[model samples]
Target: MAQEPLLRCSGMDKSFAGVPALRDVHMSVAAGEVRALIGQNGAGKSTLIKVLTGVYRRDAGQVEFAGNPVDFTSTQDAQRNGLATIYQEVNLVPYRSVAENICIGRARRRFGLIDWKAVNAEARERLAALDVHVDVTRPLVEYPIATQQMTAIARALSFDAKLVIMDEPTSSLAEREVATLLDVIRRLRDEGVAIVFVSHRLDELYAVCDTITVLRDGRTVADSPISELSRYDLVSTMLGRELTESERRGQHVGATATAAAPTVLEARDLRRAPVLNGSSVTLRRGEVVGLAGLLGSGRSETARALFGADPVTDGEIHRDGEPVRFASPQEAIRARIGFNSEDRKGEGIIPDLSVRENITLALLPRLLRRGIVDRGRQQEIVDRFIRRLDIKLAGPDQKISELSGGNQQKVLLARWLCTDPEVLILDEPTRGIDVGAKQEIQNLVRELADDGLSVLLISSELEELITDCDRVVVLRDGATVAELEGEDISEKSMLHAMAEGTAATGSRQPSGSREEDEVHD
Candidate 1:
């Protein structure tokens, strides 16, 4: 008879505070197979991992491991039962020796005292099996991040783990290190160990995963062998739509005829150390410019540099055709440049504060008189913005945390709009919100731009950029590859420019362009 599969989970369900995170998700893995778990942010990938690892309790479902049903109450129990995990951040003690990190929990004992020599020898042998040769006696911190990750894998195997769950293990590793880690994973798989790989990098997933599973909004949408899916299909599956001609039409939302408009802000060789390499962008009076590129392509860096959040050490910046230097964000704001950060939960909102307080944060100095807050004026301005933005909330005094993701974002936008800045930079503004909220925000952006607001929109969604921006500046490896304008705004062309890392300045107007006069898609 065939041997039973190593791990299987059927009808798994989990929720937090009545919000369903995972719904009837079914998954399985053989002894030596590599399974990829992928989804957008807040799509229940993390919750699924936690349920499997006992970091969370399942509200309903069944999880079977090694031919028997299991419900682990703690992570330690799960680890002891042969399921091991390695997180993006290595969890080993920094001061401990490499050998200790590997065999610290499973050390050989002698004479009622832990034996160090045997542990080091065992660690050395374990690493040697994976073709890693490192001094096991040295402190873990002294070694590079790649070596530390290898040590973590060794530790997991030391438990004789049947399944290894690697959660973004190479998120912070250098390219060379990533290659080495992939080799190690292959080696482990050859030894009959099942692996669960979770990451946002599609290239890496295609490289290592044998089977791919995609999750969308807490449901398992697609599960198939890697060979069956192309990169475009994978992206479409994850995003929940194929780009048809219907979706392409009426996508452009920003100003189309801005040829006569003058530049409001200009970046001449904007640079912030190694992240940005003499990148230049121009913001006109009534147009939206999209910053397009893959992850780590310096999209956010460009925004930060423009807003003076990051120091512009080697660039010339001008506002309203006049050259100026802004050493801090305050100076940028004073010069009428506003920025809405990508990390809304971390940098955009203070959860403990109320809606009114968060909305009026940037307008404080203007609303202050004799070192006192002008409550009536503050109320008038806050009420006006709240109504204008249609921010859904219990009351102006409601805790900002009580509001949904979209409302919190609206509050941030209000904070900037109240300032009446000449230019606004929005980075991933609709990332984790619902579909309704995303559309609302998109409409609002178009309305604002029509009223002569200069916007710099940075989003991972190509359609969003193509739909909203009059032009897109493609960046690759910290440098500008191409600038698409007029009829040149299309995903095919942008991907070409990004993949080639070269400028495609052809006048090929896409079929969907509102105007047939120009070419560029």
Candidate 2:
């Protein structure tokens, strides 16, 4: 007879604010296996992990562990049951020593007093067993983020955890650090531990996971062996699209265009202490220039500094051959520069406002006369963009939050476009949206550039950057490491520049290395 699975969850259902985040999702993990949970943003991947780790209670589901039903009312209860979760943010006390952080609740003790010496020694030994080295005596914050992440993993393994749930564990890790984590995962799997790995990095999922489960719109779309799937097929399944030649052709429509115009925006020696080095790049009219790099590579920081969302300590910004300094986003806007922030919910949109209101937000002054908005003119402009962008909404009066992520993004694009800006800076524009919406957004970007608008595109998806950009500027360790254009924008080229930081530019190499560099870069 076959052995029962180590963990099995059936009919898991969860909702947030009347919206079903996870619906009847079924998943199972066998001992000594690594399973990947993947989907677009808002596809319920995070929700499933939260439910599994008791971060959120499922509205409906049956959780069976080791062939027996179980109920966990809290994360502590779940951890006590041999289940542990390591979040992307690394949820451990940074001020505490590594040993204390790892074995806080179950510290070694003697006669009701903490055994500090034994705890530190044991913690160091445990980490060494996992092939991770760290100074257990020092505070956790003293080490790099990658080391902190490994400590979290070591702590989970120390629990004798039957199943370990990793939620984007490599999100902030460097290429080398990722390899270490992957090695640790393999060791744990060989030792009969089940792992559920959640990540947006398709390549990492293929590397570490033996089986794949894809979620879409709160439902399980497929659960199959990784060997039975191709990357394109996996992306299509997660995106709810049928595999076809036309769809693939339309995936990267912006890359074919070449820039043949004067520069719209240029940054010379842009620098911010500790984060952004003396980096420089130029954006020309009717072209999409991509800022490519891993997290903390100064891509977002450059955008912020250029848009005056953040102060710059050094460097100069030139518009049409003249130096310009923006003291605030308002100044940037007035100068015809628009920035679409990466954090949509937190920074991009006003959820309580209506779609019409949000779409015309940047142009409210234009619609105002004597401190009063012209409702008819506002409605006209909103209606035009709503139709032009194919923004799916019940009506103009619908709340911005009520729309899908794709529609919210379209609203944001309209919010800036209505202002008639010359330059648009989009950070992760297609993030967390469905496949259809992603293509539409990409095509819209191409159309916008063709219509003479300069764009600065920053995305973690390297494929998106390569295909949508007229030229790619690679950054590493807060500096411009390499710039690729025309024939040099292939995936291999970008990967090389990002990984080695030696792309014919003779730039300084990155000092720290981690796994996330591979995925994000």
lDDT winner among the candidates? 2
Query: How many collisions per candidate?
Result: 6, 8
List model 1 lDDT by residue over 85-114, tens digit each.
898799999999999899876789999788
Task: Please list the Cα RMSD from the true structure of every candidate, rounded to 1 decimal place.
Answer: 5.8, 7.6
Estimate the TM-score for candidate 2.
Answer: 0.67
Q: Which ten residues in a row have the lowest lDDT in candidate 2?
A: 243-252
Off by over 4 Å in 1: 1-4, 128-139, 251-254, 259-282, 291-328, 365-384, 390-399, 402-406, 431-440, 459-466, 472-521
Off by over 4 Å in 2: 245-259, 265-283, 287-336, 349-420, 427-451, 456-521
TM-score of each: 0.80, 0.67
Candidate 2 on 254-289: residue-level lDDT in tens? Answer: 455445588899987787765676667889988898
**lDDT value, residue 221 of candidate 2:** 95
